[model samples]
Target chain A: MTHAFYVALSYAASGIVVAVLVGWTLLDGRAQQRALKELEAAGIRRRSAARDQAEKKA
Target chain B: MSEPIPAIKKFSDLANPTIFLGLTARIVPFLAVATALMFAFGLYLAFTTEGDYQQGETVRIMYVHVPAAWLSMMCYSIMAASALGTLVWRHPLADVSAKAAAPLGAGFTFLALVTGSLWGKPMWGTWWEWDARLTSVFVLFLMYLGLMALTRALDDPAKSARVAAVLILIGFVNIPIIKFSVEWWNTLHQPASVMRMDGSAIDGEFLRPLLVMAGAFTLLFFTLHFLAIRNEIWRRRVSAQRRLAARMANRES
Candidate 1:
């Protein structure tokens, strides 16, 4: 029936939007986590180098 | 770090991004599952239903159009609450909540307009009208855009939060106006069917799936909202760290 088509269309639109938004959020979240990990790694290296230099001078 | 011992914490402790992010992460999955299940059931109900005697198959558009309109209003209300929380409690997560909600709200509003137009063309024999309800919803869309623009335009996050809070609060006044526009003015839009004082004008066959779809959309919004806010907080944290690194590099140079 014609009613069936409209119903299908509505659900399809809702599904598409929800999928896109969820996908974008997951991808962005993963990128941020990766960036945070890299920053923390670099910070640890810098701190260790600073400590080594201080001990050598002493 | 160990959890703070005090049951009641200072403003800064409550506003901590890590605490907010952890809580949101735990809740998001449940909401997502609920949304998916609800949508599936709603779709099944919608597709299996018979058309109205008068409207024929076009009555099916009501399932989507009505839910999208409900969500557009719901998202704005949530955004207003976040705006209030940000201003009153100075909650860091609240600003992120409002910012994340704006685009989603706009998307819902856009969906409402498009779906309404599609439904209207079949029912009213025209694609567009300058009716009060339509105009008010258009204004709401504009308000959503304005809030998004204001949030992004400011260089300072703190200032952006404050200004956006004000804008959201002001824009909320339009919501009630939109809801009442049909009652207050002559319009091509139909009067309230499901929300009437006596009873719904719509029969159970059409109403059931519409209600289910509305619930599904609401859950979907909340799930996405949580993820969006979490990502925003992480983004801010990463940006802050980058700035700190740049400052350190300058000092060494």
Candidate 2:
């Protein structure tokens, strides 16, 4: 190719950084959702949520 | 008969984490697709466009470098606004927005620096320069990192957000300096070309692709930001639930 090595490196670096950012965010979201699900399975509900349900019933 | 009004009626309704997360889940996917399409088109244009007479194919680096640089600043500006939200109105999502933005700002700054160095090596015959523009941006990267560390180092969300908001506001002074660095001092970096007051100095051939790519990058930034914010909200919910469970267990014991 007519392009220099630096040009290639720049693109590759950008790609890698962007990919990592997207991947990390996706994984973090999954982990947080999983944690919430586990807590829910353990019957650990947020106080605010419990209060809201009680208020609705009342 | 009047229809039943929804709970979330105005901008303030988004302050509710559940509402914010619900809306973001819908919006981010659209943004993600649009960003991808724009990037694809922009890359095509970037590759097909003629090289600069002076800089040759190396000018393609500008496609990536300039957008990254512009975004590096834009991301900080967003965080500064979020800081205001945190300190002023005390909006619930304010600190969430700021906290989510810090790492992304660092990432954009890192891209700007590395890509600028790559361009400089071929054109300026140097890999790095300590000129005003470069130095200011480097300082910005550090500021972002420092803010991130401060947030994590402090366990209390309320206190940490306050501290980070103050730090973000203080750090905002550097944005103007970075913007005008090439103008205010003798620097290897070029001054404003596209965003000049007297119209863009760049020719139309290069400008079009640059603009598309800029839009794409901006959309990508927002998409990631929304996703990060959604995750942050979920994380907070999990921790809060855990705390409640702990309290309940202590009462039972």
How far residue B51's Cα lies from its native spot in candidate 1, in Å, is 1.1
Docking quality band of candidate 1, CAPRI definitions? acceptable
Q: Which pairs clash inside model 2?
A: none
TM-score, prediction 2: 0.95
Docking quality (DockQ) for each candidate: 0.36, 0.79
Best by TM-score: 2
Candidate 2 on B45-95: residue-level lDDT in tens? Answer: 988999899988888889999899989999999999999999999999999
Q: Which segments of model 2 are wrong by more than 4 Å?
A: A1-3, A55-58, B1-7
- The superposed Cα distance between candidate 1 and the true structure at residue B61, in angstroms, equals 1.4
How many residue pairs clash in all the candidates, one count each?
1, 0
Highest lDDT: which candidate? 2
Query: What is the lDDT of every predicted structure here?
Result: 0.82, 0.90
